[model samples]
Target: MAGRWVKPEVFPLFAAVGAVVGLCSMQLVRNICTNPEVRVTKENRSAGVLQNFEEGEKYAQHGLRKYVRGRRPEVMPNLNKFFSDPK
Candidate 1:
């Protein structure tokens, strides 16, 4: 059946590497999309926090688009106040 475990000894090392490469490409797509900054090498996008829902969503959409377009994210995170993070 599908996904049956195959004995490692049955395949050459290169075969294992090829299979890994195929699987890794899918992971790469996810990793590329998840970053607020769509930039693959830089942190250009960031999730923004705002006091109001309208403003917060506005920036979130901006950030999301930046990555989707392969551009840098301009989202500005909340900088107006600070709170002790939950322990």
Candidate 2:
């Protein structure tokens, strides 16, 4: 009979670690492809340091930050609003 190379108990831990690594790698690839600051075009290469710094600052606002900019500061917005409402 063939011997078991890996124990069954450690499978879930391996899966979780793989998932985290995959997510991070995908995010990095997405940023590399979409983020202008990371790309060096002919115009960008010729620009001065101050211009590059300003451009970096302009693109530094990530998608998540833009999404949350208008959101209320609450852990559970709907639940909190429901309970806090005066009847």
Clash numbers, per candidate? 1, 0
Residue pairs with colliding backbones in model 2 are none
lDDT of 1 by residue, 45-85 (tens): 24343245664455466654766686334353343223434
What would you estimate as the lDDT of candidate 2?
0.75
lDDT of 1: 0.56
Q: Which stretches of candidate 2 lie over 4 Å from their true place?
A: 1-19, 30-51
Off by over 4 Å in 1: 1-11, 34-87
Find the 10 residues in a row with the least total lDDT in model 2: 48-57
As for candidate 1, its clashing pairs are 37-45
TM-score of each: 0.28, 0.48
- Highest TM-score among the candidates is held by which one? 2
